[model samples]
Target: MTLPTPLTGVVPPVCTPLTPDNEVDVGSLTRLVDHLVTAGVDALFVLGSSSEAAYLPDRHRRTVVDTVTGHVAGQLPVLAGAIDMTTLRVRDHVVAVTAAGADAVVTTAPFYTRTHPAEIATHFREVAAASPVPLFAYDLPVSVHTKLGADLLLDLAAEGVLAGVKDSSGDEGTFRRVLLGTRARADITDFSVLTGAELTVDSALAMGADGVVPGLGNVDPEGYVRLYRYCRSGDWARARAEQERLCGLFAMTAVGDPSRMGGSSSALGAFKAALHLRGVIDCPATAVPQVPLSSGEVERVGKYLAAAGLL
Candidate 1:
């Protein structure tokens, strides 16, 4: 299916389910896909940050894209992340995922090397030129170490090099500027600006963001869908209430002991644990090298789930 001109509504960044040995568990992956699709998300984003794309090998990434897109079967757009350290590598992923049946590809700026804005612009243009499908810029400064400037994004939008942007920078001021700038630019039609801020869906939608890619939505897809519907229908009160509830659920990410694990371990571990508790997937095992959540942390995830009425 063709992507929506301006992709809108809730699009959850799906978490990858791993086997005991760390292979992509296709059975669990499909089950998770059904969970999100049945919950009424607008799209499915696989191999994203939430999916542990950075940790997975190239073969596993292909398996994920192929599995999800084939399972989705055109019900909704399947956007795969072509995350890498530079242009050529990203291009290779873009080709692989698209060949594996992804509708579009998302990527971040080149990283691991200091890059100028001009270089960033050129990198995007080069990648876009080679991409077989629509390309979305993933502005995740925390991961890429490069914040995508509004002017650069707008300039690219004007040039039709970028079909959309998934802004995960968490900078409200810059996010608002992108929204307003896109709205004000007559030449930049069909440029989607999706927010990755899980806790601020209401405010971002209020400020005119096209949609959301909430990682927490992996655990509570229905909540994010409800939040999106509430915002789109102009029910600010209901939206705020739902957002606050999700904010509470999001606290589960912090349940892991900081002394024992890194942020990815805590956050991603919590998500997989929630999914396991909810019986959507079999094993809650995260990719290797990331510490597993303790039984205590898993119980805490259960508490969050129970409180959210998900259990």
Candidate 2:
């Protein structure tokens, strides 16, 4: 059950494929895992933000973990999100996902309730103390509404309260600060710094990030794998080219008219639609309450795919 201390390479926060009736689409999911496995992704992340973790019930969340971990069969390490509004709830999720076969747990600070840094620190320490597997802090201010400062992260890393960070805060300065902070510490040799910014993998890698958890990687894992390899080999030109192509493909996320749906719907819908068009999944349906893409939006996604040479 051991993962590389500083887990590296492309790890897409996998998208949850749903049936029209809003159930987890098992067949599509296993096939998606098979697709990522074939593409040579370093690991699998099943129930993160990209996986619609916010929308799933406890039973469905467990089903997702069981399905992905069971199908993966130990081919790659699996990390599941243990997100909630408080310490006890997150600890319960940590217990559930790990018991269901998650190799590690990624969690965020308490949300939906105002909290202090002291409370947040206590929350992480208590949660980590209760977990069997390694715990990673997830710094996604957009959803959690609390940005994890570099000082706090480094302090946590120093104390061994966190295995790594999955950062989606879009703050490049803090990203570099975390990377620099970790390298400066002789004892913090294995703390990973993974960026969730899909558009900037090349920049992130060049600046010494450990890896990426790009949501767009779900639609194109091989592209990210190639990009990561290019960066590792110091092939800046090729990496830039690959990243530019992916950036263009990412425009599909904006096809869902802003007036009609939120950015989350646009992005997740585009990923699923692209996956369906790529023949990697069946029924590009997202969960309920998130507006689905329109016929026009789906066609726009197909055009982006065609342009990206994915269709």
Candidate 3:
């Protein structure tokens, strides 16, 4: 299927299923993909933050994109994260994932070094020019350390340098500003604005976001799909209910003790655990350097799933 002009609906940043040894578990990954497909998600995103792209080496990254895109066989658009600290590095990922059959590439602004906004703009332009598929900006200020200002994103979108943006900044003011800018621009009809804020999905959709890229959606994609459909159909009451249930499930991210692990480990581990508990993946092991959730934490995630009716 061709990517929609403004890609809409729930596009989960799929968790990368890995073996106990940290290799790409292709069989488990395929099962996870099938699970998402069965849940009616509009698209799949691989090698993203939720997929541990930051920790994955180039080889595993390629395997992920190749496996997911090849498995889907064009049934859904596969957006791969071409993430790196510099333009050249990110461009290389773009080429590799594109060659591996990704439908589009999502990248963040330069990181690990202080960069002027002009340089950031140049970086995106150069990367977009080199990418074979459409490019989407990943606005994740927490990770990248540079907020993608609304004007800059809109400017790039207006210039056709970006096909869309997945705003994970957790800044409602700026997200709304970007949405308003897109709505105000006559030339920005086909640009997508997706929110990664799991708890505020209903509010984001009500504020005109085109879609959501919730990491939690990886576990309960059916819920996000239902929320999207409810919002699209103007069933605000039902939309809020679904959103609230997902919010309850999202609390599982807090199950891991903060002193033992950072939010990435806790949240990602909870997600993988839930996927494992749901029988979507074989193992819930996250990449190295990130602390693993204890059995107690995993049990807590199961409780959240049960409370959300996912179990």
TM-score of each: 0.99, 0.99, 0.99
Question: How do the residues 1-311 of candidate 3 rate in per-residue lDDT, one tens digit apiece?
Answer: 56899999999999999898999999999999999999999999998899999999999998999899999999989999999999999999989999988989999999999999999999999999999889999999999999999999999999999999999999999999999999899977799999999999999999999999989999999999999999999999999999999888899999999998999999999999999999888999999988999999999999999999878
Q: Give the winner by lDDT.
A: 1
Q: Give the lDDT ranking, best first.
A: 1, 3, 2
Better of 1 and 3 by lDDT: 1
Which portions of model 2 miss their true places by more than 4 Å? none
Residues 1-311, candidate 2: write the lDDT tens digits.
Answer: 68889899999898989999999999999999999989999998878899999999999999999999999888899999998889999999999999988999999999999999999999999999999999999999999999999999999999999999999999999999999999898778689999999899999999999899999999999999999999999999999999999999999999988898899999999999999999988999888798999999999999999999987
lDDT of 3: 0.93
**lDDT for each of the candidates?**
0.94, 0.93, 0.93
lDDT of 1 by residue, 1-311 (tens): 89999999989999999998999999999999999999999999999999999899998998999899999999999999998999999888988998888888899999999999999999999999998889999999998899999999999999999999999999999998998999899999999999999999999999999999999999999999999999999999999999999999999999989998999999999999999999999999999799999999999999999999999
User: Model 2, residue 270: displacement in angstroms?
Assistant: 0.7
